[model samples]
Target: MIPGVMEAAVLNKPMDIELKQVPVPGIKEDEALIRVHCIGVCGSDVHYYEHGRIGRYVVEKPIILGHELAGEVVQVGAGVTNVSVGDRVAVEPGVACGRCEYCKSGRYNLCPDVVFMATPPVDGAWAEYVAVRSDFLFQLPDGISFEQGALLEPLSVGMHAMIRGRVNPSDRLLVTGLGPIGLLAIQAAKIYGVTEIYATDIVPFRQDLAIEMGATAVINPAKEDLKERIAELTSGRGVTVIVESSGNGRAIPDALTTVNRGGRVVLVGMPAAKEIPVDINTIIDGEIDVYGLFRYANTYPSAIQALGRSDIDVERVITHKYALKDIQEAVEVARTEKETSIKVMIYPQL
Candidate 1:
């Protein structure tokens, strides 16, 4: 007995957001209708709001924006079997055509025909209800809160970076950002058995939060010599893995300087600049392997399992919450209040 219409926050243009009643989405044969409980505001969402695009994904028309979300399943189509009414779940935002080669090979994140939520031309979960493929929804464990469930999306990013970096128990890692992704990356590294982890950021609060999230040490890159500190911490050998989530142009060369020879540098952040100058000799001399990460592939189940465990506290990163009506302010705080806000969440039902 879902309503025919639901409230949604629509982005008509850059910096123009409006709340209006829109028709509830209809479920497909393999889709389920969910009543959204919580949605996390991501940097991508804010980027689209403020800049109207990210790279080439431009918003050509009115769109609903938000992707990191968790909710209760309220309706299902004929082919839906994985979730039922009242099941609390986290939504994996990317939907790939099963016939695609990337999908068949388990690399659906790179699928050419994939329709990812909030990435232009696809309406996302900033509304009261969303209809998503049943397989993309994972049931939340008994003790996991909706906020934590929504956070699985960013957690998946960190997990994907960890996998790409091939982080191990013996690896000493450097995470160059204190954003939500950086904080989650530190936690992911700890979960992967890396005992020595270092994090650097321009913001002190975020640096402190990183320490709380299990970093062995935190550095302020604006005031401190990051490469020298890493040298001191690693006893002049440098770290084995550098997880660059900041997308800062300067961080790239710093990573090349601080990473151990033959080590890996995983780039998770999307840089604003289209092209960055790189010293080919530096990369060649160290034989540093660089890896690029897009949104995660095949990580939803592992993210859910990690959330079910008690050791990792995903909720700690959340610093602010707002009702759907306050989405404008929410996005502003997330964009302007970086030092004080790590993760901002929205409650559509509120």
Candidate 2:
């Protein structure tokens, strides 16, 4: 028996997340009603909570703000057949219009009509009950916890960046920024057979965590010369692949300098500055291939498979947990405590 109302953490505006009682969302014929179990606190979620916007997306009205989520199917619409009630699943928050050219070309993440969850106007999975399109939900194996299922979203981002960078066994990779995405990139690189992996971050905890997660070497950019360290690691040849997840203005140019000639640099981070000056000369002279990632496409299955394996312990990244009622505190800790926290998770059911 679905209740008429459910509890949710609603952002009335920036820094104003309220635990309110809202009507359970109704599902369309192709959608299912999920009882949200765990939701990961993404950097974008914190940005929106603190700043009320990210680039063009703004909180024009009240919205629920969480995208990385996992839940159990409580009910299904008449037309839903892929999953039934009681299925544990991870919800891919982006619902794309299948008719778009990007969708037809198998790059639905680029679909112009994508209604991404937690992106303004699209309510996300912060509530107790969320209506997700059946196609966007992936079943979780029994062994995978809800927390790990929620984390698959960020893992997918790392996987996508690695794919865009064309990571291979022979490639020496450099991952800038040891945020959740950067850490996951290290795991993804290892899975892809990249033996030599280097990571950099300003946070000592993150740098140490990166090393624990199989990074060959970790550098503290604030204290050390990053370019010199990369040069020393690569014997002055520079890394073959660079995954720039920091979005730090300085990291961008440094990556260009540290990447080998004809190397690939994949930009995964959303930079704080809209227009940072780039070294166009280096890009042109080195013939470097640069790729920009927007969310992810066709990566959930791979991410889930990777998590199923024992080699990569994705759960280790979770450093904090909070109930839905304390969402504001969770967001605050995630925003202020970067050095100590890797990932903060919210248990909506609690």
- Relative to the true structure, candidate 1 reaches a TM of 0.98
Instruction: Tell me the lDDT of model 1 at 138.
Output: 94
Off by over 4 Å in 1: none
Off by over 4 Å in 2: none
TM-score of each: 0.98, 0.98
Residue 151 deviation, candidate 2, in Å? 0.6
Candidate 1 clashes between residue pairs 3 or more apart in a chain or in different chains: none
lDDT of each: 0.91, 0.91
lDDT of 1 at 180: 94
State each model's C-alpha RMSD to the native.
Answer: 1.0, 1.1
Model 1 residue 200 lDDT score: 92
Q: After superposition, how far is residue 203 of candidate 2 from its true place, in Å?
A: 1.2
